[model samples]
Target: MSGSTATTTPQTTIRIPAPAVTALRDALLRPDGRERVAFGYCSRSGNDLLLTEVEQVPDENHRHSSPGSCRPTTACEREFISRCTSRDLHPVFFHSHPFTDTAWFSTLDRQLIDRFRKWLTTLYPDRDLLFGVLGHEEMRIERVTADDSRPVAVDIKGEWELEQPVRPTHTAAPDAPAVDTERFDRHLRAFGEAGQTKLANTHVAVVGCGGIGSILAQTLARLGIGKLTLIDPDEIEVSNLPRLPGCTHGDVGQLKVSAMHQRCWEANPDCDIISIARPVQETEDYLKNADIIVAGVDRVTARYWVNQFAVRHLIPYVDAGTVIETSDADPPQIESMEVYIQTIVPGVTACFDCLDRGDPDQAYRESLDSAEEKAAVERGYIDADIEPEPAVIDLNQLAAAHTVSAVKRLALGTQPPVAFRKYDDVSGDQALLETHPNASCPTCLGNSLALGDSTISSAADQEIATAPLDDAALANPLEQTDRTTRDWFPPAVTAFFASDLAQHPTTDP
Candidate 1:
């Protein structure tokens, strides 16, 4: 279906739920001599589009055009108009080619598409028609504008049964031409040709860039995600080298998002990486538009916000964390090291809030969002926590690996939508348990707009020009209030603090 338009050449991202895509592909796949076409409706989210449902024009309702022209039977035509024309839903038409591996529109095919658009205009004059050719193990999508056809990235959330192409198409452009299949040959055996395509089209957004987030980004790149968005505000430190893959001593002071963005690009030059050096809260649009969100933030509040935001946007989410607990026994033995991965499919699975709702620590977790609150905990003002939890690279890596796998499975619909996968190091125990949605959960209840929110725009407004990471802190944040500040105080209030602290600071001696 159609949605709002953006800049012309680079078409908007098309988001289809994983299953919807699988259904569409299955419906379109056919014998070489036979013919078929599939159509569907989709809602919009900002500049991006989505595929909401698909229905095949039954064989009885359409004529086969094997090596020839084909048209819908009168009955099929009438049904299409009745169900789709009046609503302004964008109509996507798919047809198969006799040959496999690759596909291109012929002169007759072009004429047919033009005629179809003309017929569509009689029903909805302003509607734009979308077209696809299901070639051998491959698919090509185009936006038929009044002037020309524009290519758009078709991002399917979760996983899809790929079209087993007769062979891998030359999936590259001339200017940027390079060998594409050699690197993924190993992957092809596991996911098959179709799965690799699905992986290539998946758009994943990672909300943190620390140990867990960095590992997740790298793994997703290696997994063949075509596009990735990284959202984080922290910079790398010497201490980060222990766990973050691809981050070396040379990158010690770079922005975590920027460094990891480079690492992913170097891994898969085919993938488009959008690096946002900012907190997820400041950049909600990325989370909303991504096919899936991999939550890797350190703060509980950030995770809480991501769950709600993801639910509101109907995006799949994978969140994970690791904790190490030790006992004050005679030998001060390591009591346990636990890693947990939580995956959620909005409206389908139990969201993070649903799980937190039943836990007594929810209130405490909710309150620990602020730097001051964290400082208080470190100072023992909060009794529940002795201090900040220690971060280990191996633990973060273990949890990230599981979370990334879950992220892939969530997109593929192979795993339970709401499940907690836990690993205990000391006890050598592993469990994956299904989680139930809260009966009174508001988000699950308010599934009024499934892929219907187009008001939230991308991060253009929230985007800050990403600068190369400086070795030093660059400037005191208090001193650079005019340049940047998220200090939780108004400028005037900060001024008051400056004066108050200055007046009382002689006691520091």
Candidate 2:
């Protein structure tokens, strides 16, 4: 009689969810524990498998067995196997590794595997049963056979290093919209055929998915940005509904990155969206590959992280913020709404530190003072006491649109506006402040280009770049200033009035 040997294909290894690992570790720590240590295996989906449930095994505690020993009762075994089969999950043999250093498997481990093999063979003769060795420091997986053989260690490290799963290219759902080839062509042209080629190969990271960020992402997607990494831990709140487009009431508790991914896909299906639902600290690897970073976060902590990351990587970062205020005493009186846009080109523009060092409280103080002034106006006049209706959606949308336009201009090699535009509805006039970098700005003092080998010689040794201002022509307000004036209109004003007689000739200011 001739005998044939059966060989099984190697099982693909995947990362166990961190939570599940923690749960298993916690289970092993119990002492008088009748706790049922349930184990089930499912094929890897994306990063990890969803651990469905764990049922408690009663009166099955093995006190005499090793601390890690998972000697499930006959009933528990049958129940586990039944549930796994119903859920189409495989019954990887389950055993506990007591928190000990002994490298070799105990005799009990072999006996338990033998018992499980007998049952697994009857149910899945062709398939191998997986065995998990859960220890204090590590967890090991192996395969078992019916011949009362020792388990084979699963190579976890080797498997995890393999490339990501190759998903079908056209796996998009049937209801998904068809590709817009014409818009794609237009996007390519707008980014410059050569530029679009470069951008397609580049990866961009957006730190926040708020008002400015949402629009920024939309613009990038429409521009055919090849790869995008979105990092945000916030959920869509009711307060954010007015500013955040593409978000609905249903998305109130949903992750910002998920919402952003949906919007990006709808904007451009070809663009890749890497959604990171965790905080920025937890997603450094995603930040490492970013070619350009768009900072639309309102928090100082988040902005600091972005600034540090951008400075370290020499990546260009565009920062945008808008402040809207209304007087308490005046109805329809917009106290002031100032919009600030700053572009920090790694080696070119002064870093944020440089600007902050000069006048640390300048921006914050200015914003606060403006807000207070608006509040005062609202409180001073009895007519203003009447509460003004909340801002309309169009106002926030208008701000976001301008911000997105600015980002596009920067990406297209156009110089971004440096003047902070203050729209004052009460005075019916707009104030423009030329936000020039202070020579003593601390942020810029020690800044050295990331790409260059040269280091900053000394804080005082750095030279400041200055541009000449044409103050003489603007001195006479009666006479029209240069025709090339950028108007900063107040909220309720009809006519554009030049605030100062002098026009700054140099673009630096």
lDDT of each: 0.67, 0.52
lDDT of 2 by residue, 187-260 (tens): 66555564555455446788788777777787778776677898888898898788677888999988888998
- TM-score for candidate 2, residues paired by index: 0.43
lDDT tens digits, residue span 155-185, model 1? 5443422343121122222122232678988
Global lDDT for candidate 2? Answer: 0.52
- lDDT for model 1, please: 0.67
Please give each candidate's TM-score: 0.57, 0.43
Q: Any idea how many clashes model 2 has?
A: 21
